[model samples]
Target: MEYNTERTTLKIPEYGRNVQRMVDYCLTIEDAEHRNKVAQSIIDVIGNLNPAIRDAPDYSHKLWDHLFIMSDFKLDVDSPYPIPTAESFVGLPDEVPYPQKSRKFRHYGGVVKTMVKHAIEMEDGEEKEALIYGIAYAMKRNYLKFNKDTVSDSTILTDLDEMSEGKFKTEGIDLPHSKSFNIAPAERNTTAVRKKGNNNNSKKKKRRY
Candidate 1:
């Protein structure tokens, strides 16, 4: 028995050695008409190997291309579609550019940075102060959530000051303590819902009589 190691390497291994041998036999056919007919038959055989390709728009075109590729582009047969050349292949895709804008603090997120920038441009008034306080409070909450540890109000103030480029001062304003935010309302709501469901199920167990 002839082993693959001893045999010449197939151009396209997916077509198999038998298909490759058929392709080799196809190249040796003297008559152009007979070669074309044999080539079409060979395409039908390979095309059946992958019935999924029939759904494609250029199904026959792809099959002819595969035929040329299997024959090492030496098969002189009439093709309906444009025959591909080595030079026709486009190289690797273009590189995508990295984002220019980046957040000052990733944990605090981009929204906080935007708020800080907006606050810096705002007029000195009551509305701006409220927005500033809200931003700071949100920052602390995000920091706690990400780190899963309690943070001091001063740390939040210092971070807010540094991130805003010392434009926003946290001197007079006092941030709310982390203790209040420990128990999230969402968790409480979920627990309440589960308890209510259990009560309903227990009630359902009692007869309508």
Candidate 2:
């Protein structure tokens, strides 16, 4: 799918260089099994890097975030389809760190909003599939999700397997996972009081007989 015209392109030359490095590294691996493993890792790395461009405090620039997300999405490995390149990096302002307090910030927000709009416009298939994979990978690795407990390699592998099968579902949006429904002490106390009130009323009615 074509990216929104308003979103700015990223200025990171190292991103392309890193992709090339990954491609080269993948080519060097001899065994097909090992190569596939490395390829998956590279894909995971790219996926992780994409969201960081937008979410990271350091790379708060909208153009940079949009470019990174698109470039990573366009990168094709082992596909017969042609992969998009840095030359495709278009629609960005020539200046860096766009005037922070200027009207341009509104334009940048519009660009991001448009990108999301286009994402929803995309039909269910390869484009949606790639996005799901990218998002799932990011969620798994993000510190917020696993702050107290570290996610195991086996768990990642299991999720990867589910992803391959197209059964890997996200909570709330795609699939609804069972969430804890704990009753607060105050709520429990309130229920107890209500029950006691009903019991007292019953006792009063019986005494009237």
> Which candidate has the top score in TM-score?
1
TM-score of each: 0.41, 0.25
- Whole-model lDDT per candidate: 0.67, 0.40
Estimate, for each residue in 1-209, the C-alpha lDDT of model 1 and write its tens digit: 23223568766665554457667878998989878866775676666554566787877877787788778778988888887765554542122122123534766755466557767876776545756787788788667655545789888989999888998757787777777666354543454566577669878795231
Model 2: clashing residue pairs? none
Candidate 1 weakest ten by summed lDDT: 92-101
Best by lDDT: 1
What is every candidate's alpha-carbon RMSD to the true fold?
29.2, 19.1
Give one digit per residue, the lDDT tens place, for model 2 in 1-209.
11223324433433333333444555666777655544554444443345534454543344333333434544334432334455665664233222122232121222222222333444566444544444433334331121334444345435444434544333333322212212233543554566578669987785321
